[model samples]
Target: MEKNSQAVFPNHQHSRGKAWRWTLWSVLLAAAVLIGVLQILVARAGPILKGRVVETLKTRFDSKVELDRLQVSILQGLNVTGGGLRIYPPDDVMAAGAKAPLISVDAFEFHAGLLGLVFKPMHVGAVHVRGLAIHIPPRKMRQQGAAKPRHLGKVKIEVDEIVCDDSQLVIGTDKPDKDPKLFELKHIVLRDVGPNAPWPYDAVLTNAVPKGDIHAAGSFGPWNTESPGDSSVMGDYRFDHADLNTIKGIGGILHSTGHFEGQLDRIAVQGTADVPDFSLDTANHPMYLKTEFSAVVDGTSGDTYLQPVQARLGESDFTCSGAVVNVKGKGHIIDLDVDVPAARIQDFLQLSVKTEPAVMSGVITTKTKLHIRPGPESVTQKLSLKGGFVLKRIHFTNPEVEDKVDMLSLRAEGNPKDAKPGAPDVHSLMTGQFEMSGGKLNFSNLNYTLPGASVALAGVYSLDGQQFEFTGKVRTQAKLSQMVASKWKSLLLKPVDPFFHKDGAGAVIPVKISGTKSAPKFGLNLGGKKPDQASR
Candidate 1:
């Protein structure tokens, strides 16, 4: 009986051990089968996701899509890596001679967990893109069509974030000869990316023309597949340390802040720009310049039309409206209509002239057309102006010049006693039609008026205040004999007074002004010819 009990215990122990082994084998087999299924799913998902990506972009952009390589791995999670992806515009929408791809990417990578991948909208933690480039065609060249709505069928993609460290955006022009505008993006980040939804983005890019860094944050549209220029955009931007010297003719360190909204083709922008040391290269004299402007910008062609720009230079204020357009070979051409209600002439002279002190000081009003041609030439050489100006209470900065003018006024009034060395300063009025080119101002129908005399002149003056040539007729109210203090000299001049009298004036004399602003020469001109003509 004891032997039978021991054997039964051994048999029970063996049965328990067998049960444990069978359970272990079943668990191992289930795990192996699950791993095999996961492996198969990963393998199948690689091709399916690759095709989905291509199809999604093609349908979304209405363009041809290409993918060089796509790889999927599930080491810790489902990961995707793609290289050499490109999207080309559809034939119906592509511009005539346009061959560049609309978008291109060197490589991109993203990761998703297994549970995230099984969902209807796949949630990607982040997408890192390298060497992404976007090229937008000209507005005029793009054909109009209804955009096709985008759909992802059963599975959709949602990204938590997308980061691009280096990217580029090229905007093409309708004119074939013109160069395209380029923006180099240093960093870009888009959050909450989804289909047909506005994407919030923050970007830092370099402005090509001004050579500046721009930091912007905004929301951009899902997309405009039919006409990319019609894509809606709104943003706030800050441009810093923009070097205006890149334009060749001007120099300044500019800072600006602005807000913009509307479509890509036509954006409304309002901004203020400040340049603490703005200067023309010709003068090299810096001045503080500030402007508040409202403009419409054509993002496609890089053209800007100023509805109005209010500007302040030093203490003077002015308003202008114009267009800054991109020319074929000349780069940007700035054409503006400038109006100054009332400003100090010295402010203008100090900014444009090389002289340390302005040659004249007065209140000046002007209406002018200002045109600046882009070139390697200096600002003075490239600037052209057609205008009319009126000067009131004008006084020459030099006391000697003012004294000469006072003496002239005194002599013209037949007050010879007051024409001596200690005469008081006299203010004058000047009005003229002027044209400026090549750093020189030419005046026509120039009228200069004092208390007792008026002069009508035609002249040219160099901007450097180094050259002056003028011819005019001075009309005075007093007779020639009355201009002399001595009785004998008056008697001697009485015979010649009749010869000098003309045009209902007691005396009319042909006069000429020559030499520099510092030491002007005033003389009687019996022969009306320029100084160059006299030299010849």
Candidate 2:
């Protein structure tokens, strides 16, 4: 065949090769045109796509989180966020449907859209954030229950980077009882976290740092019914300067740090604080408690309210463990088991001694429970503790002592007055039995003021809270002595040894107070046939 004819017909292999080349060129040209169209379409559709996505997210999330600027790239399949975004993981992941609350980030850039980019994929860029606010829910917000059900889903908003200056943190959520007049935080600089990146934290809230009215930090996460103990968060908190209005009964320069972790509502903790100077001041300021201390508590789901607690006071170095329980709607118990090698009753008797003294300290080893029943009537008003204490030394200062023999071991009890079966019903509860034993009581050396100072030999004595009922004394034969003042000497009917004799100067001879617990009576026996005694 001629060249021209063969070319037209594509002779054999030449024809096959020519057809293959034409097919390849057509495919290339079509791909190039399609890509060009796709690029233009993406540019044109970006704004609309962004608006639709924004509306969709906004409608789904409600006002829990507000996303600032949103943009979408269809061609590259990418999205970005320029504002607030928060993520609240679901509480019960097992449940077919569960919801969590999310906080909004101030502003941030996000890269996420190539999830389906298989063969030739893409990389989403990083995000940015500014001015973030985090919240810790209390008893209030939990009860809200989505405020009439606008939608359903966990609170989740993803972001990239964050930058903050003056931010606030809410300790607990709002309650109908009115936000605690005391819990508020202002001016805080928090840390930053990420997904594929290490939790880079340069932030530090040390002593007196991150100054705010209140400070709270701990390992926090939403609840997981399947695994309650799977969380591994550490607690760390520092509240620099904050108002103490919420603790209506107490106030101060709140300096505290502690270990914390666990779910939001119920948390576990171990921490300490140094209240340099604190108070409950109205016009000026009324001081409440001042000391250094540490504490720990265990919490769980449902019954996880911080009930039983343990605390250690540094100044007195006393350790106390107890549970704060509300009983039968009338009594509030601060039930405790106390062990104070050196128990100083400063905070316990705040009103009695505005300024405390170191000598007022004592070593107290006892198992005591304090129950407080408050009532509008006298019958219901009582503070009771029934237990035994072995006192090392409890001082009621005697100025006459040039030697400062200011130590005495006293086993004393303060039982409530009496309770009547048919008596008018009141919120008051009786103070149970109080007792102290096995202690050395060294009163002031009385040598200078009168004669030789008197000191009681080691002994155990039991008194009826306010008076002496039946005196139980333990002693070695060592004689006890006392000094007599000239004025008081005239009052003694006879001169005798005060420690052993019933008729000696300054001798408080053993007397019995008796009667029904309801109406106690008192009696005295001084070498007499009978002495009238009844319950007081």
Candidate 3:
């Protein structure tokens, strides 16, 4: 009986071991099946999620979408990778002649938790985009109608951050022939991206026109899907090392800081700019220039209207208002109304003239229209001015010129003996209407006044201070006979003094001024002869 019981126990143990093996096999089979199912789901998720991506972008942009490749992986959270994506503008916008896609990306990647993917609103930790390009349509092509309500449906997406290291933005104009404005972005970062919500952003970009680097940070969008150009934007920017030589006629190293707010199409900006070495190519003399300005800019067309600009050059102060407009084929045209209530003529001469120690000094007031046309010409050649100016307490720097003026005033006052030598400098007044072009100033109705004489003249003065030609009549209180120091000559000229006297003056004489500023010659105009010929 003992032997039989022992044998039964062994059989029972064997049966138990066999049962354990069978249970282990069943568990392994179930696990295999589950893994197969998961693999299949992951394989299919790529196409399904690809479709969702397309649908989301289409709804968000209100545009047609195209995608080249998509991949999905669930081993490490949920990873998605895509390439060759392009989003086109609305049909009507395309019909309006916009051929470029609204947005395009060469590659992109994002990651999310598997649980998050199944939730109502997907949460993505981060997204990285490469080779992105965004093109903004012209104002007329953008939808002017009321915006449509956004519906993200059951599956919405929220991203914590998005980064693009290389990107470009192009802004188009309504005119067919006009060139678009281009901005090259070196790096950009967007934070807390969600539907119909403003996204905070930081960016570094290069401006094409003035060729400068700009760093900006602010909030942009809550995007206007219907009219991207109408997207709201507010930011502060710092522009550095802007090379103004990109413009044909001017040269400067500019730095600016400003704040701007408004829709992309129309932005209001307040800023201050400093040019430590501002100069005209023709003059080649650098001057410190600074300005505080308020302006309105049309981003689409790159047109700016200056509400007002308060500027200082050296010690001189002025104000100007104008528009800088971009033409189709031609570059920008600058039209300004400039007013200088009080300025030093010496400051102007230092800026414009090549010679050191300006030829004259005085207080001047002027009102002028300044026009600059874009071309290959130098700034002096392209600049045109129409203005009127008044100069008070004028004093010539040259001793010879000052002495001559002093002598003339003494003689005119019938004090010829007082004009001997080393007399006190006399002040003068000058007023004129002037038009400047081709590096020359033409003066009309020019009036000059001193103690006892007044002269009216019309003439031209070259900018180089190389030539001066003037003809006019000088009226004085002294008789012509009294103008001579020689007693015999004075008596001989006394008989004909009545013939030279007129216009309520003791003597009226035709006078001419010619030669250079450094060596001006003053003479009597006996006939219509050249000033050189009339010089005594």
Candidate 4:
């Protein structure tokens, strides 16, 4: 019995061992077969899969379309390339093939997929695109009450490159006869195909015609998709050898280099600009200065948006705040709550058509605003300007006196009278009932050379703030006639007119202005009718 039991045990053990080995081999073979099956499915299923995607799109939109080049491949496990791509317009317009432009993407490669190893969220991948051009026709939109969906109402499409240099753009149109300007991209250049687009603005643009050899680069981050405000941007913008501005008179071999970095939603910016020897039509004619500019701009609030903006022109440091300088096309004004603590006043006055050069000097402090708005609003609303200017020390030009009368100093400061200081969102320091009735320019204690006559100007302006009709007359120990006759005549000289004479001798000039708020008509004539000739 013992011998028989031992033999049976040995035999049983051998059989169990053989069974275990066979089971292990079978499991390994199955796994290998499964992997092979998956590989085949991936290889053969690409065309079918792409077709299904196209079919899905067509079905969802209720349209009939076909694909030419249907190719899909995976590096690790992501779409890399797809070719023979084309789009067919609706079938109803099949007879009008001429009007319907076809769309095409040459070679499209996509990268980026889940790592799926231990733990990693975002996938990283880069796309490589070959020559791609698409002639996407316009959509035909059906009229109201139509039986079919919106796609039936769409129109044909036409595509063309409007402006191309630094930027390459493909514009779409409804009809071949339609204007090519329907859609446009200012400029675009493709450097590295990226999942993140509109990146590297510098890699794109090349020129600015009316401006000059233009080079631009900027950074834009997507924060809130709706308002893609500038979160942070650093770019060098250069306009080489541009023409001087007719109005600004800042002309010459112009060159500027600047960099800006800051947030946009809660706007903050800091940058430096170098305009070396940027010539001005006026004298100290040509001046070169490097400006370091920094500001916290509030875009959310009107008051905050209207806050002060500072610029250091050359060695001159000035703060400009108040009123908004609305611009239209070529015309613009420094209209707003704008002030200059220590600005060269001569630079401005000389730009006007004056018989003799009026050299004035003063620290300008004025509450003023300008307008050049061209829009649906009335001209008055478009170019509406209502604010007063305050001049502190207005020095007239004079070679004889210790300080020339013409070398005037003006100190001005005025706020929006009725504007109530806004909430924390706004940047209004003070707000209240503004005399939107207009503004007041108060020239207090104007001290002149000899007679010690102080010039005082107090005037009320038009609703748009363009016209200043006030009781402004010369007051001095000497008669108004005497003050003008003495100092002004010698100053007038021979090159100028006799009737116009000098500043002090002029008549009690009345003022009137009327027009759009932005472009009001101005008149100052005491020759005939005092009231009829003026109205603002």
Q: Indicate which candidate wins on TM-score.
A: 1
Candidates 1 and 2 compared: the better one by lDDT is 1
Question: What TM-score against the true fold does each predicted structure earn?
Answer: 0.89, 0.43, 0.86, 0.40
Sort order, TM-score high to low = 1, 3, 2, 4
Candidate 1 worst ten-residue window by lDDT: 144-153
lDDT by residue (1-536, candidate 4, tens digit) is: 99999889999999999999999999999989977966775676465455554654354334455556555445466454565555544454444332432334455554434232112322324434343343333233111112444443221111111112312223233343333221122443333322234344443333332245556666444221211232244555555665444223345455555454554424444545455555433233455555455545332221123345555553455555543222323222334454556555554444221313433444444444544343443233344444443433445343322122221111001111221322111111111111331122222222222232233323333332344343323323322233332355535532332343345543233333334322333444344332223332
Q: What lDDT score belongs to each candidate, Candidate 1 first?
A: 0.84, 0.37, 0.84, 0.38
Model 4 vs. true fold: TM: 0.40
Model 3 lDDT on a 0 to 1 scale: 0.84
Candidate 3 C-alpha lDDT tens digits along 1-536: 99999889999999999999999999999999979977986988788778778877876776689999999998887899998999998777888777889999999999888776467467787889999999988878775334556554443666789899789988888876567766698889999876679999999987876888899999989887778888898999999999989866678899999999998888899999999988765456788999999999888877889999999988899999999888777787889999999988887877776656777999999999999887777778888899999999999888888898888998898888788667788889999999988877878778999988999888877777776888888999899888878799889999999987897898988889998766788888778554344434
Which window of ten consecutive residues has the lowest lDDT sum in model 2?
A: 407-416
- Backbone clashes in model 3, listed as residue pairs: none
Local distance difference test, candidate 1 = 0.84
The better candidate by TM-score, 2 or 3, is: 3
- Residue-by-residue lDDT tens digits, candidate 2, 1-536: 69787687646778799899999999999999988976765565445434443544454434433344555565445555554455442232212232333344566444556442222222333444455444444433343333344454332333333334334333332333223111122333223332223332223332221235444443332222122223244557665665444333344566666666554343565555555445422112333343333333222211212323344433444445555443333433444565545455443333222222322344445556544443332211233454644444343222322122211101010111221122221211111135332111111111111121222221122111222233222121222232222335534634454445433323333333333222334344344321122212
